[model samples]
Target chain A: MAAEVVASTVEIAAASQVGMKALGAGLAVGLTGIGAGVAEMGIGSAAVGATAENKDLFGLVLILTVIPETIVIFGLVVALVLWFV
Target chain B: MLAPEKMSRLLIVASKDQLAPITGALYRSRLFHIEDFVVEGREGYDGFSIGKPLAGASEASGGLIKVRSLENVFAIRPDDIDPAGARKRHDDLARVVDRELAKIGTEVEGLTSRRSKLEASIKEYEQRIHEITPFADIPVDLSLYRGYERFAVIAGFVTKNVAIREPAESRIVKGKSSNFIVAVVPNEDRADVESELAGAGFVASPIPAESGMPHALIDDYQAKITQAKAEIASIEMNLDAIRQKHADFLVACEEVLKSEVEQAEAPLRFATTDQTFVAEGWVPSSRIAGITDEIMKASGNRAYVAELPIGPHDVVPVEYNNPSFAKPSQFFMNIYARPKYTEIDPTLMLSIIFPIFFGLILGDIGYGLILLALCFALRKYFRGEDAEYFLKVIRNASISSIFFGVLNSEFLGFAMPWWPPYSFSRHLISEHGGHGPMIPELLLLAIWIGILHITLGRVLGMVNHYRQDHGEHRMKAVLANAGWLFVMWGVLVIIWSGIVMPLMPDLTGFPMLVAIPGLPMDIPGINVTMVLGGIMILAGVIFIARDSILEVVELPSIISHVLSYARLVAVGLSSVAIAMVVNFISIGMLIEPQLENFTLIGAVVILAGVVVFILGHALNTALGILGGGLHSIRLNYVEFFTKFYKGGGLKYNPFGLKRRFTED
Candidate 1:
């Protein structure tokens, strides 16, 4: 009887684990996106101001603004692995 | 493919009479880069002084100023007049310019003064009318109020009529809207009465210094003000008519006068010796025949053109000769600095590499197509020289990205049904582990790319150093580069044998068993690869600088530079990952749910998902375009150019006119 009870409890634990994985995936994408937004705020404004003065800097400023996007991308990869894989 | 055009200096000698036509010819050819004649350097030459402007320059300049004033007054633009008509008018203008200007000047001054006089009188009468209108109800002559010797009249508009003490008679005169009070108080009681009037907000009005009734004077002032206004309007109408009549002629006159001044002053840049003039300039080798022919024809064979040898001290200006396909890359190179005339132009190399780097970073078919569409749409609206070049680079990057994206089998981060077995990304993911995250494999690929890129840089550096000279120093530089290459290959092999072999023992045999004898491969922590790499690095340090041991520090920098390419894989992986997440939320969560349930709530969810889908992809595509484009150029500018390029050469700017208003 004790062995049967243990086996049933393992199945429930597995179900909860799957639910936790989904939560973790959501947090990874959401929180990292916020972080990317915060980092981009300063860079994006500075880039715009620079590009306004000299249009030649448009390409350069764009690179600077999207540089922080790598962080969110990392979060996205993690989320995909958790949910999709 | 890689070299700039060759340049040769020229010395042109011509008689003083021929200097004007010769300089004009040079300007017309648009092939000369003139070197200014300094007065201090004329000591060796006989009686050489700086050339003065031609005799006609002063007159032309004076006419230019007048023409500019007329243009401003008439608001005339060159584009508004027909070119042929303007040319004819300009040719005939010299005879009539002075006369027409004097007549127009006098007429404008007369009109201006008349208008000002009318405006001044109108303002004066309007003020008088306002003052008299308040007291129009008094029904008495203005002289009566001012000549009252015993009675003190306090009259102005008031909020209300106030109560006054006895012996002071108060009368309320109706104003335009408010009531005006006339209080005749004795001199002694005036102070007390004025205080009571102040309480009612009374502003005392000064009687007009005239002899007519208040209402009659007000009507007379109003009539005169109206007449003055009508006259001013008529004067303005006449001015406008004059402006319209002269607008086309004024613009034509300005263009003609400006060109005349430019031509007349051309002799100032030449060296003169009372009888003959001398000028020095550089012209491209190919254009020498054309320039010489033009100058000879223009000067009637009076001017001599001879090519002088380039000197060691002379700093020659550089102009690239890249093909049209590689011309756009010159924009990024120009931002750094023009390459020296003697050095290889890196534009062709950059054009090939930059797009490849961008394509590798943004390897998504959907995103690439979106970027390509964006470029096509944006290129139409943008104008100017720089804008066109910027758009061209973006278009090239988009094309390259699309090509690589197809190889990756990624459409908005979702794997396509048809995957090519030969694609690098597909093969990588499949060989490593087709499930879960493939970050480690991506990092490995990025490092391998970094190794290849940096090695190519070192090889270019080797060629550049060897090209400078063939001597002891050249050999030293060549050996130093070779040693660096050896060290790079050695370190990579060490990492493979030492770290990779232990992790994946089945792929390769143990390094100790396969080690070749006489090499330093037997150390415990270090294998044959590590020992060989160390020996090469030490040898490189010695070759680069035999005396200074500090050169060894640079060995680590080479490693770091290679590792920097890891960002390529990191960026591409992140982009793909984000695209997958977008697809999951929009399609999997929203669309799939609606397809399954077909409920009202499901439809609303799908609507929200569509918004998320559009907005999210747009943002990603924009960031990808920006990041991929810039980073690709940056790698060339920062990583690749540092290996071989040394910029700071002056650009070749030929002395010529880029005229838009008039043709030569």
Candidate 2:
């Protein structure tokens, strides 16, 4: 009975640590969306301005706007890593 | 020494009846003055002497005479001249002319001085008239039904008989209670009579005369005022023309004096173009290709050209395209070549960086959102390119800030796990000690970020050099950048494992030795690994120092070039330090509590604290961005550019349609 209690306690502690890490990862990625939105705000406006000046820059603007989105992708990767680990 | 010059002339004749048409054709050719002679009994014969040689005309017409001489005509079309050399000559001439004109300007002052005295007398008479008629009002009436043509108007009558003075034609009309008096006079003489009447204790006001006929009493006053104004304007116009001519003459005189007094110089070169002719002067060897191309394009191979190399270095080749409008070219050439043209085009680079840095420093999600909204709204409402550009930069910076804020793990001073999923001991809660994992991690991250940015700059420099065909230099830059990156990484790794102890021990002895002594030696946690880490750090420092010192001597080949990235670290550290300070200040505001009953006061205190936090952080963010962005640009200019950039290459400017605001 004493051994079983000790085992269960250790299992719960391990589960909690994993859960905490997963929570951290999720928060990182979820919060990164906010950051991504903020970044897009600048890029989208710049893209619009560039497009207005020269329609040929549409491709360039689209590419540049997506560059900031990489930050969020990184955050998402971190969350996936934590969950998988 | 002056060299011998050559001359070319052309002569042509047409029927006398066609003289006007032939002259117009010659004018179109931009050739100067044609002399005509009338032959006895030859009523239909006209002859033209075109004294000025055509720019590129090899063929001759039957009725035109063109002459090319060594003497330079002081015409206005300097744009036909080489831009650089012509600009220098123009400036030299302009300075001398300005000095001489300034001396003559004193004479203008004397003429204008008399105007002030006359104006003062006029004002005195006006004041006296105003005093007598203090309570008087001029009544004007317009009626169509007075049995007059179209409309009739009556104005300004006194109940008592005031001695009426008619300066021009006096006319009397019968009225109900008073006799109406009318006058007709020129506008100028009317003003003199008005002043005279004012002096005689009568109030006189001159209104706009009805059609061509004016009131007989006021007509004389209006005529005098008109004459005065017209006289002043004519005098002023003459004065202005004289000033301009004096200036031009003075310039020519000064050039002659400088040549005689200082050194024997070449004759002045002038170029002009008009509806008929395009005249250019002193085409340099470097600019010959461009000028020839322009002429060929404009005149289609029919230009008349003259070449006279009269001075040791003066090769004056003048071409006249359309001479009628060519004089303004000289004026254009005079104001060209300002330093602003060669300065770096800041538009593109500024657009990219400003907002990114601004946002990073601002770092608060809420505040960034607010700024983003404001900027966007302002840009939308104000339809200007500058406003739009500003908004774009702000939006980018805010985005960078949001990213930085995430790394900071802060949102309105609230912790990530607001309702703690699992609470650690409440006893462990201390303001300084309990900061979440973000701060230390961010500090480390900033250093790495600096390294990355510097690497990117070096890579760009390498690419730019390679594009310019400097392969060896590009290779050197790449190697130097790589060496620095390796060294920095190596040192960081050792410090991470041996001293900080947050990560597992990975790297060995050299770093430990240098880091131990360099770190707080008396700190309790100093260990053998720390000592080894210290040694490695010291070695890295020595490597960097050695390369820097050697760069002054043998140019460290490619190894020393990588040191330019140190600015990246410097700016990043500055940003981090500013961010920390902002956090501390904001947190400090929430420290003291108000009395228990004064709950409202407590809320007010919180609001004040929030305000201070926002303002203080916003200011710091602005300063940080400016510092970082400027330093980043400095690093590019001073370090990277010195390695590869050759910025002195001359710019290419093609002649095209230009507008001069000075004429209007």
Candidate 3:
């Protein structure tokens, strides 16, 4: 009975470890997306404001808004790194 | 630093006597007043000075003349000769000249009328020639071949022949064809004609008819039209010069006659009235004393002067001032200042808060340094009115970024040496778990910021209300806003503590309250306390709703306003989540031992990773800035302003001299 209990405990510890690794990976990916979204929120608003002020700024606004998307790309890299590691 | 000062006094004056001198001085100084008054009774003076001499003259001779108004005498002194005469003598001479010119003018009018008739006749003949030219000639070339012989036939005839068929009758030939012989040939059914032609056994191949007169007539008409058109063009070119000379002569005669009439009547009596000569103008404050002295000298000490405070009208005129006169910095301030009179100056507020917010969101020392460098560089490059505004914004943002970077314990992505050299050092340090300093702390800070911002907005709203004649309403807004803030803070604090820990226990058998199994959970005591705290918040919300609804007796409307602050959490959460993602991506990529040593591969990976990270964060920063800024403004304008602002005041504008283009 003692042996069985010890084996079960070991199995549970290993499972928890695997779960943590998975959770970390998930967090990395999820955080990246969130970051990207947050960055875009500000950029998008600014772009729209600029475009509203001057119709000629359509291209410039678009470029500026995309600049914030880098956050998401970074997030993606982290997610990939975590998965590979 | 010296306190800034503004221009204080301005005066502008317009008068008939000083018009010439003042205009000349203004032109030389490149300063003038914009006059917008409509002349109410100009017709009374139409004939009064109809022939008056050009102002600023000494004598009259030949083309020189004199004009006398009721108040002043003027003579046109031509460069070539002196115009010398008493006002009355000049006036008599002018009358005689006018009488002679009038007689000559009549004759000229008759000549002009005759010339017009001649021009019309010439045009008609030109048009007739053009019409006759195209169809003038019909020529025929025929080749006839018998079995053993060949002959060529050529003929020319007029296509359009104009003839006097009778003594008074004329016929214009419409069509003449070179193929007339062929057309006149009879068919076989005309047996007599066919038999007569066949009797000779001569199979006749008749050549077409031709004419020469139509061609000649067309050419003749074309030449005539061209000549006429040339003559008309030359005459039209000279017409303007002729008219100008005539006009000048008439004006000279009229001026002479008017001078004579003025002398004959009252010897140019100067009309006097006690009109004080009130005028207003704008001058650089530095030059105010000089301008006042000059004005007094010119007015003969008959003007009153005073200074007015710099109001909206004093600073920026409403009419006749170019829109571009507003400096970019002033314009930016005006964006938040002038639109709603009751609102706080957003320029001042933005100058304070935007940098702090940016630093909080971005929070990396290395990144902050980069931003500072970039901002400074951009400031140097873009140095103008607009650039000044940008520089101010960037200067503030860079300071905030640096401050946040220190607080967040990040230099680049690397942990500072003072802290544990690990990404989760703070979390690890607090693992003994009593009140942890970690992600949760960061989130709490964001919430605290929101609370402060909302509170400030409410305070501003109340102030605005009080200023706009709603003292009672302002008091209510203040109370309601305070009540909610206190309730939210109190509840949040209770939930943060573990007072109710004993009510529920976790799987570890520890005392807990309100713990949920199989889900991420905080301590039970904190959870239960949060529930209680939530009730307090709810109560405060109800009270705020009641106050707003009661003021307008519209209960439903208050719900929308209360819910609006929810965006505060939404935006904050978005920023935090984005940061976490960036950190994750930066750490996620595997660095194999063998590949790590390969400089090229490592460099490539690092470059790609850095690029992605920077781009992602930049995007997030931009988005957060814009979203937070706009929503922040929206909250102020709608939820807050609705509580107080009354913004329909007309902007005051004053007329002032402005140059559209500058030569120097």
Candidate 4:
């Protein structure tokens, strides 16, 4: 009976470990998204001001604002790899 | 289709008396890109100086300054008011407008000065009030606080409660408004009393220069402050009334005065002798006749227009003359640099390729429709120089996306039954019986596109080289471009045979390459076709190296440029993947299982799915636009433009009126 309790406890801990890994993956993507948001706040505002002045800057400014987004993509890729593992 | 219009130089000489008519004619014709008249000695040229402005220039400039000041005062832009209405009002005030403007200008100046003085007086009164407020409870005349030989007064603020120690004969009084105390002590113990006050964190306040009691002086200053504030408010009201009456008039007057000043000052660009003024400029070859006709007609033939024979070295201004459909692409070209008159204008090329690249990455019918709707909405709501070109590009891109979306059979993330699948749409629809990884197919398609695009550039460059007067450099360019084209084809063939063939084992019987058989000549893991491709590439490298040894380093860049097309695959794949994840979260997990029963909980789940769907699609659409638009533009600008474009031509900037409040 003592052996059975120990085995059940070990199984529960193992399941929780997988759950923790899933949580870590979620945190990675979420934190990176928040980071991208913070970066875009300043760039997006400046881009809006610039586009307001000259509409020709729309394409260039869009490119600049989206550059920080590559960070989130990297994070998402990392999260996917981790989840798969 | 690519080259800018040919330009011809014009030298017009007219009498100084005819300067007015000539300037008027030039302004009206609007075809002359007038070059700045530099006074320099040349063959058949004599002493000349820059022409002075017309007689009315001073008055016009003064009026412009005044109207601009009025604009600043009112904080109103010309576009804020109705131009047609302002023009009518301007006409109504034409006879009396100048007098009214002067009167209002002086009145505003006087009011502004008075308002500033009142503000300064108010500040002074407030300071006096502050000085007196702390001692309001002292109940002694301000004069009594000072000029006392036997008693010493130390009035200030202290954070802690005051305590009279021995040898400090003191009377401390605290005020109601703040922790400010007024203390009196014997003259002998004044320093001791101040030290006691200092120990309790006391800051001294200066005595006011008044004779009345502290409270009475404070009240008097408050009354004066209120009176001054009232005067300022009245002055502001007067200014506001002036703004209300004259904002539109000011904007119109400003526009008119500015035009007058510009016209009067136009002679500054002309080279003048004692009696004759000579104007030299370039006009489009096509418009040369039209401009001559207009100048003669407008100036009554007083100005003699002569076409100067332009030499090869003449710096001609470039003007793009494309159809309205392709005209918008000039925005992109202009921002990069105007194409030289000798080189091809790449506007039409950009118009064709930019949309294809944008569409390929964002190929989804649902998203395309959304973008199409947005384009329509933007067009309906906004109208400006900025909106016009952006909308033009977006409209083409949206249409192309719709077309590619139909080809790909995608709506949002889901596929339609009738259309071929994403990977199969571009390749053999029948042979690949099952779906394979689309990334490889997309990458291959992207590389093929790169090859074709770069080849077109090289061909255009070669044609440009041949079209020019042949020199050693021109011959080298022709050979190098031809060799690079050969290398590109070799690389394409190698990629087709080596990599694409291995992917599909079932396919067979394509074009066979000549295998160069040798003894003991083997590199580990190198393919036979690649080795053949290397030899073919060396042929181009040899030609390039003959001209510039350093240029051979750029050979690897050719492969990198082709590989850069992988962005097209990566961006599109990311968009599709995100959309699928969104669909799964919204529909697959939430609504799929309980969707059949339609209970209250199921209804809630469906509602949640709907919300998720909207938010998810919104995010995806934004990302799609950024990625699709920029990556496509990057491929055109970084890859294609670097191949052949050498853009540093002067844009043709003709003198013309920016008519805002007036029709003529």
**How close is each model in CA RMSD to the real structure?**
8.2, 22.8, 18.1, 7.2
Score every model by TM-score. Answer: 0.68, 0.34, 0.43, 0.78
- Candidate 2: where are CA atoms >4 Å away? A1-85, B1-358, B373-391, B406-439, B467-549, B552-596, B599-664
DockQ of all candidate complexes = 0.14, 0.02, 0.05, 0.10
Give the chain A TM-score for each candidate: 0.87, 0.80, 0.68, 0.91
The C-alpha stretches of model 1 lying farther than 4 A from their native spots are: A1-85, B41-47, B58-260, B420-422, B426-438, B462-487, B501-525, B546-554, B598-604, B659-662
lDDT: the better of candidates 1 and 2: 1
Error of 1 at B440 (Å): 4.0
DockQ of 4: 0.10
The per-prediction tally of clashing pairs is: 0, 88, 52, 1
> What 10-residue stretch in candidate 4 chain B is worst by lDDT?
B500-509
- If the candidates were sorted by their TM-score against the true structure, best first, what order would they fall in? 4, 1, 3, 2
Which candidate gets the maximum TM-score versus the true structure?
4
Q: How would the candidate models be sorted by DockQ, starting from the highest?
A: 1, 4, 3, 2
Quickly count the clashes in candidate 3: 52
Docking class of 3: incorrect
Considering summed lDDT, which 10 consecutive residues are worst modelled in model 2 chain B?
A: B62-71
Q: Fill in the DockQ of model 2.
A: 0.02
Q: Model 4, B334-392: lDDT tens per residue?
A: 66667888887889999999999988989888899999999988886665655778888
Task: Give RMSD (Å) of candidate 4 vs. truth.
Answer: 7.2
